[model samples]
Target: MDLAAEVAALTDEFSGVVRVDRAGSTVLDAAFGLADRRHGVPMTVGSQVAMASGNKGMTALAAMSLVEDGTLSLGTTARSLLGDDLPLVADDVTVEHLLAHRSGIGDYLDEDVESDIDDYALRVPMQELATTEQFVTVLDGFPTKFPAGERFSYCNSGFMVLALLAERASGTGFHDLVDERVLRPAGMLDSGFLRSDDLPGTAAVGYVRMDGHWRTNVFHLPVRGNGDGGLYTTTADMHRFWVALFAGAIVSPETVALMTTPRSDVPAEGQRYGLGFWVHASRDVLGLSGYDAGVSFRSFHDPVERLTATVAGTTSAGAWPIARLLEERLVTTSPAA
Candidate 1:
């Protein structure tokens, strides 16, 4: 089957970029639809798009770097870093729990319980949440849902706390720390946490369908991203991130192993939760995915096959169809029984 041709045929149905690479060789690279409808700018291979929650892996790597430098440990309590500011959060919730999604803390933007992404509203105005410290106000008022080391719960608030911890321990801004300790080492020069309100010309404008009309997502998300989500990157840069990660450039091999090791089951998603990456145990694939009002992304690396696939979309649900098509092709072409 001509997978590339098939993907190309579906261009009109999706809006984004798709890239597949095997053994360091490009297999498929294509872009579709308008990046900025108002300006008539088409999506390009170099166009940067938001990765919603997809950036959690980078945040995890930043924290691990601090661990390597002896500044923080996985067992460090969230309370120690945050102090009495957020009294509802339990004192037993440790860094490890947050990384593995086992903290069971009340999520400010809970995905599991919230069926429709559009129905969920932010308590704090999006513009006010420009920094990690500013997010604490909205993160308050929610009590801990369960014990610290309990079962996994995908909590966006937990990761915001992680961003706070990273800043406190490293004495650096969360964005700068990730750029220095993660993106620079991983050769992802084009990737960073960018403010949605003021974006560069190369950045894609996220769109969502509302009342049969397309609208921008500027008001749906925070003005700036925290640790939990919101990083702008290109498809090539994302592929570079995967390659560098597997090559042990961003984090130590031992640390990567620890981070990617499956620690809890995410039954609803039919996957397992690792430190910050999603694990497909049978296929030995590790990945990061995200979905917001007008952003969608999926990127995965198959270590056994030395393959990497990425799909980044500019609309709410545009990336999934293309990603599933690529997954189908991968399964059919797999060497394993």
Candidate 2:
């Protein structure tokens, strides 16, 4: 099937966007279904979609950039930077632990401890937990999950601490530092952290299909996104991100290699977690995935074919199927896919 036919089939049941960049060229760039179904606004290549935990990679990169300048060190302790703000965190927890998710700290909305995002947001008033400082007290009353580096357990709070440290080191806010150091350099102009109540024009309004109907997801997220998540971006911009990241435009080539190195060994067979991405050898492609509230995203860059494919959606359910179908097509057509 052609691009249009493939997209139509996916859109018939879902609202989403799929973007493909093959050998530095756009093989497919299309948006299907609606960004705001009530207003009949359709998603476009320029439409902004939430990246959720996808922003973790960007945050990690931002922290590493400061490390490159000697302003911060991977060995720097979170306690030193945060001072009295995060007295609950262990003094030995290093920046590396946070970046690698090995800090084993308590998460405000931990998947293992907490069952659902919707329930968690209800208690906190999603709009109130906007900045890293505002969220510091969430974990203050809770004890550390493990000492500091007992093992790797994904922790949202750890990333928040990293954001605070990054901001302090650069003497700038987390959002501004990322804009100047990472997004601007990568040319991701349409992407930034936004408040839950104030979505910019051309941005997709996330929806959660519940009780056999799609509902807009406003209360399901935080008021403002922080370092760990809550970033809005376009597939075209993400394609540029992968290029800039892998090509060492944002960091040194050695640092890029270090970021891609798998730090934690997953107990599940044949899987590992890198600093900011996931390492999978299913078909010799490196990739990452993020899902939260009403957003779902996945992207892969094939080293052998020099090709990449990314899928993003306003709703969480649409990303995986689109990603799988794109992979199937690419595998059948290319020598390396």
Candidate 3:
């Protein structure tokens, strides 16, 4: 089967960028449709797209660095570092709980409970949320959903607090610290916490399909993303990041091992929650996926084949099919055991 062709066929259905790689070789690197339909811009391999909640992995990596340095432990109480700033967090919630999405704090943007992301954006202007401290109000209003370590609930607010903890413990701005320590070290030169209004060149403007046309998503997201999301990056850069992460270039092997370790059970069938990555086991691969407004992504590492596959999309719902196609092809093309 021609996997690339199959993925290409779906591009007009879901306008965005798609890239795939294996063992340092470009297996499929293609872009289709418009990145900026208004301006008629096409997404290139270098075009940066907002990964939305996909940025969680970088936040988790920042937290793990503190863990490696003995500044904080995974089991350290969340309240201890964040103090009165997050009075609503349960007493039992720990750093690990946030990392693993097991902290039962209320998600600020609960799509299941709330119908519209734009409605929540109205309560607080997206432009005001530029720093970790700015997000405190969002978490403070939501009560604990359950006791810490009870279950995996996919809490974005939990990660927001984690970013605050990193700032408090490291005595550095969360965005700056992550950039200096994590992005730079991982060789992710194009990734950063760009303000929603001032996105860099080569960055794809996120769009929502409305009335058979695409509208820019600047007003639909927080002005700046915290630990939960808001980093812009390219597919090639993300591939470099995954390679560095697995090879332990950005953190120790011991640290990466800990991040990859399943910490809590996901209610989603056949899935487990790690520090920041999602682990899905089917037959030949375990993977991570993230989706949010105007962004979709999936990446997998096949231990049996010693291969990796990644898909990054500017639209909200195109990554899985592309990643799946690549995965099926790679597994079939793998050398005999």
Instruction: Please provide, for model 1 over 62-101, each residue's C-alpha lDDT reduced to its tens digit, 9 standing for 90 to 100.
Output: 9988888889999999999898777898989999999999
- Give lDDT tens digits, candidate 3, residues 212-298: 776777877788877988788777777778777777888998887777777766665466768888765434344656676677777
Cand. 3 TM to true fold: 0.91
Report the candidate with higher lDDT, 2 versus 3. Answer: 2
lDDT value for candidate 1?
0.87
> Which stretches of candidate 3 lie above 4 Å from their native place?
111-122, 267-269, 282-286, 331-337
lDDT of 2: 0.79
Please give, for residues 1-337, the per-residue lDDT of candidate 2 as tens digits.
7865785677776777788877767888888888888999888878888888888888988999999999999999998888787677888999999998888777766756645543335356666687777777665655688877788888777778888999888899998888998899899998898776888777888888777888878878777788888888888888888888877889898888888888877765355677777665445466767788688887777766777787888786678788778767775457753
Off by over 4 Å in 1: 331-333
What's the C-alpha lDDT at position 117 in model 3? 39
| lDDT, model 1, position 82 | 92
Give the winner by TM-score.
Answer: 1
